[model samples]
Target: MGWIEKALMRANRWHFVHSYRTIIAREKRKHPQDRERALMGAIGAASRADFAAQGDAQVAVLRHHGLSDGMAVYDLGCGIGRTAQALLRDGWRGRYTGADILPELVDHLRAQCPGFTAIVQRKLAIAAPDATLDMVFHWSVFTHLYPEECFLYLQDIHRALKPGGRLIFSFLEFEDPAHHTVFQTRTANFAVNGWSSVLDSFLHRDWITLWARQIGFAPPRFTSGSDTADHPAFWQSLAVLDKPAPA
Candidate 1:
């Protein structure tokens, strides 16, 4: 790209960040009395039913991808224990830890699902020891992060995972028609209004595969967002990257 194009991109990003912060501030003002509500809104879950439904769908996806008992698992960007609660209800007997950037979400997760380890994640790093986890997954987390941020998280996830461990996360892509709606809405908002409340990032399969390979993971597996036979409500495209076990 030319220098002028690069400069324009940076300016747009700065505007989006400013608008996002403004929207967040407005939300905070709207929910001064209820931190939990504000946090839930930020994550796009409006009510307990909505949250539980989404959690159930996430649990289904995890199970479909071979989530078995006794595996040490970490839920990155684990907002308010959505999947954790579902797992607990299903009598999941495994070592589970949940982490998120928001302390209120972590605290609420702890309160909602006692005995499950939930911590406030300040940086784009996992707290677990190296090679200790069986699986690390996040739903609707990477869809909002920049490409570089996603790459950084992948590097840390590789460090935290055991050999042959998996990183499963949901994302958005332009290849899927269902996802184009999200792209259209966000882009239209930005183009017409000059800013949008949320920043929606999209990734391509080729890019993700390249990143995974560069980070020493096996070729990543992708699931279409429209494939909802298993998890009806979870529509975001999913990717699974497994750390290669030693020969």
Candidate 2:
């Protein structure tokens, strides 16, 4: 299953490219046998699925923001296609594209459901061209991105979206001064693009809002409460951005 996990994770390579160093390596060390650790990992995955089933909050937020049936939707960094599956289950009767950086994930998705066109590609380099999609959703994807890479993807998102399209994403934020210094100095990997960094890149509401404006998006909304948002939870945020209507 190590190989399987590696392959599935590889599709979401950008997020894990040495970003999981401290965690995975530590697990391997603690459980040199790795069997016990693997079981724990399996449990964790099952728990995530259960949490999604109980209530896919992202779906609720998307629908509230204008998502509807038959819209061409792209689930970027779709790990194992859970959200994609949830979308289908949630009455999203649209042309769906689940794009990721790992071929293994697409393979698993295909093996599980051979209906949609799953593309193993980077979010910054989308499969469809400009103004092609009705909406683009990146649930928890941005939480894994480096600040620089996040900016790049925001630009890509601007180009990929159609006029009047919407883009939603979530990130980590430093709710207090204690987190500010951590995120600023930490470097998860040499690539300079990873989540293990100490800062709440997602939680830093101001910088993200300003950055979105730079990417042609209108102002962004954020906070740390019901319907607003908080941090360190399994999901740090659920940001929503929309494209302008054509002239």
Candidate 3:
């Protein structure tokens, strides 16, 4: 890209970030007591209703996977502690670690939810030791990642997870023909810097299972019909993978 194009992209990113900040500020003022609302807006939710539904959907998925109290949990791309907040509200006693790429969101979460640990994860690696975590949930994370990026993170996640550890992550599976048409066109000319544009990357169920198997994980179970997000970035299909423990 030329300097002028680079400058334009920079400006666009700034505008996008600034617009998000403004909406968050407004929501914070409107619902001063509702920290979840503020945090959801800070991350990407457009409205409090959407945030609540999405939170409930995520919690249901966790519960369905047999996640219970006292399990060590990691939330990848844990924007503004949404999953952390959900877990807390459900009375989970897990050791929760929330990691996100945005420093400001991480800092805010560190201050807001002092009980849980939050980190600004610059790399694809999760900050947990090998075979330590009971579960790792990546909400709307793989949606933004390219195939190579997804593979790198999956490798790291496999290293961090314990035997029998569960991995739950979301992706956009192009089941709809209309969506597939657009997804194919965008991915053909995809670029990393255009995350906001090319972030809705699609994945196939067979590919997910293959990737999981390649990384020593059991064949992944793909589920759809999760609650929808107002934002275009959040994917509807979720992949659940389990690390095999020694017999």
Candidate 4:
């Protein structure tokens, strides 16, 4: 891209981030005491019922990807324990740790799901010790982050995962027709309404493959967003990366 195109992209990103922060501040002011509302707003969830349903579907996907008893799992950007709640309800006997940038969400997760560890993180790094986790997953987290930001987080996730450990994350890609709808919606919102908190970002498969190779992760496996028996409501694409075990 040319310098002019780069400048335009930067300006657009700034606008989206500013608009999103404004929306979050407004929600906090409007519902200072309503934890559920705050949590839903932060994660863009419509209702507890919908949240629970999605969480259950996510757990199904995780199970399909080899989630089982006694494994240590990390939930990055784990908003309000959506997957954690589902895992608990399904009687999953695993050490589950969740972390998010929002303290209120983390606190609510702790209150709602006892025995699970929740942390409020402000950086792109994971809080776990090196090579301690069996699995780490992000649901609708990378869709809002820039490519560089996503790469940094993946690097940290690699550090936190044990050899051969798997990492699963959902992202939006332009190759999928359905994902174009997300971009269209955000564009219309910004054009007509002048502001929208939604920062829908799309990633290319080549970019992910390159990042995985550069970070020493095993080749990534991609699952189409349309393949949705496990995570029916989520339309974002999924990528699975594994840390290579020593020879």
Candidate 5:
């Protein structure tokens, strides 16, 4: 299964790259006057409303986990600097490191947002030292990563976080019959970019919890409903996991 999945992923690499180009072209057409919106569209979030909602959710999770000024933060899949922009706009003095897989988008983010550090990272990895980051946030990242990539990224994130550091990520939780078609089609690795399709995805709460434990994290905490969100919206629910401090 592993080898077969790897082969398929390699075959689909072009599709992913083409998808970005296609998005950039379309977003440029749709928001010619607003480059920021166009860039957001290129990163799989073209709609400003949806982008704002997800960014807000990310900030809420950070604050809920005691995020404060001057703390070091690592944002994985930092699409268009949405979370970083929000954090800075709200006066978060924390050192921000925004990393993404897309180089073009990262270039745009770095050019536009000079306050935070941005990098284009490859190979499903975070470029930070062990026990270095105070918090790590991953929004809508796992939805596209293959299972193995997910595990590998989680391992890398675990290595970067300090003891008692908090890791917040969003996933497409397996729920309801509406997702049946996608699940039946893709099983573990499904992705059709720009089709509102949850690609390379499908996860359960227990599966995430088990993986967290195996990655040396404490028990995972799931937050849903209105506990953190200002308004009920179509954003991913957050899972807060912690690393154990010294004995």
Candidate 6:
């Protein structure tokens, strides 16, 4: 990391520790997805509200290209299986596998969403056969990884996907110059000892375009963020990494 970036990160950490303690390393996960939905409803309490607002913005992207039953979907960072549940609830007749790095989370989804497979994926690896996943989603997952890790995982995600398969994800990208700036961008208290508490916390914008090309992801579409910020760069991208060449 360059000196300025390192210094900026250090400054952010100090600010959080000295001032933003309450929000830093928060006591509880603020966004609560209704766990009950994992059992009965398609969306859980944690992200239902936002997903509701975006209007399943990600799913709409896929449907535009044609999404239907008989397809298989893999939720890469399937936290609490909220998105997975939502997809199924929408009468998306297809196979669903929700994978996350958390085993407890996998158990929750497995018990709650019967017939839904919750695979424990600790690293970037997708625990599926090559070219198995027909439709995949990282959801808000990439918003958490380090840029380098994001690149690696993107490749991994590509490997697990079938050629011509679709991969859906969102980015904290600076696709437009209208927005995407950090002011008083001090460290979120999710930092420890001047380091990040969450993996995706320190992300900037450039990584999006770089990683997309590295993974061979094809042309992408951008959707504006539904927030007051109104910064065009706070946009979410729905990209389909082109199918990899056969091994």
Question: Which residue runs does candidate 3 get wrong by more than 4 Å?
Answer: 1-39, 176-198, 226-235
Q: What is the C-alpha lDDT of each candidate?
A: 0.84, 0.64, 0.76, 0.86, 0.76, 0.58
- Which is the better candidate, 1 or 2, if ranked by TM-score? 1
Whichever of 3 and 4 has more TM-score, that candidate is 4
Q: What is the lDDT of residue 16 in candidate 2?
A: 42
Q: List the residue pairs that clash in candidate 2.
A: 11-102, 70-93, 171-202, 172-200, 172-202, 172-203, 173-203, 183-198, 183-199, 224-229
- Candidate 5 Cα errors over 4 Å, as ranges: 1-10, 13-18, 32-34, 44-46, 176-200, 225-234
The C-alpha RMSD of each candidate to the native structure, in angstroms, is: 4.3, 8.1, 6.3, 4.4, 4.5, 7.8
lDDT of 1 by residue, 1-247 (tens): 9999999887755443344455556667879987767666767787768877888888888898889999999999887788999999878899999987666668888998988999977577899999999999998888878898889999999999999899999998888888888888988998999966677899999999999889999999888877777667567889989999999
Give RMSD (Å) of candidate 5 vs. truth. Answer: 4.5
Best-fitting candidate, measured by lDDT? 4
Error of 6 at 22 (Å): 13
Compared with the true structure, what per-residue lDDT tens digits does model 5 show for residues 84-177? 7778667789788998777877877687678789987776778998999999988877877677778888899899999989898877665635
Model 2 lDDT tens row, 101-212: 6565566556644577787775466678889998887765666666787888888878889989888776656674433543556644424765333222444677778888
RMSD of 4: 4.4
| Worst lDDT 10-window in candidate 1 | 14-23
Model 2 alpha-carbon miss at residue 54, Å: 6.6
The residue pairs found clashing in candidate 3 are none
Candidate 1's TM-score reads: 0.85
Please tell me which model should have the higher lDDT, number 1 or number 5.
1
- Tell me each candidate's TM-score: 0.85, 0.70, 0.75, 0.85, 0.80, 0.66
